[model samples]
Target: MTINQAIRILDPDTSAEALGEIEYYGGLRGKEKVLVACDEACRIAVEIMRQHLKE
Candidate 1:
């Protein structure tokens, strides 16, 4: 499934761990961490949406 759409990257579940380095650095846990990461990743997606809306 999709996680970060700006990069059009899917959530690869083949990793050894679900939690990544960034979530650890952000001091987030579980669903909170996922939410935070999704929010952060959406910045560019939001910008692109805005650009399309203006066009």
Candidate 2:
């Protein structure tokens, strides 16, 4: 995902760890936080996809 779209990229290996980071960043947790996380995730997805597309 483009850096413009989000802060850090999340991975399966660090999903749990990232969850905690997100909670602290968003200042909340649970489903609500997941909803808010969409924007960030979308940014990451776009960045990764775009980079792959570049090659």
Model 1, span 1-55: residue lDDT tens = 2434424322455222434544555573655765665565566667778999999
After superposition, the stretches of candidate 2 with alpha carbons farther than 4 Å from their true spots are: 1-9, 24-30
Q: Per model, state how many residue pairs clash.
A: 0, 4
For candidate 1, the 10 contiguous residues with the lowest summed lDDT are: 1-10
Name model 1 segments beyond 4 Å from true. 1-28
Error of 2 at 16 (Å): 1.0
Alpha-carbon RMSD, candidate 2: 4.1
What lDDT does each candidate get? 0.52, 0.63
Cα RMSD to native, each candidate?
A: 6.0, 4.1
TM-score per candidate? 0.38, 0.44
Residue 19 Cα positional deviation in candidate 2, in Å, after optimal superposition: 0.9
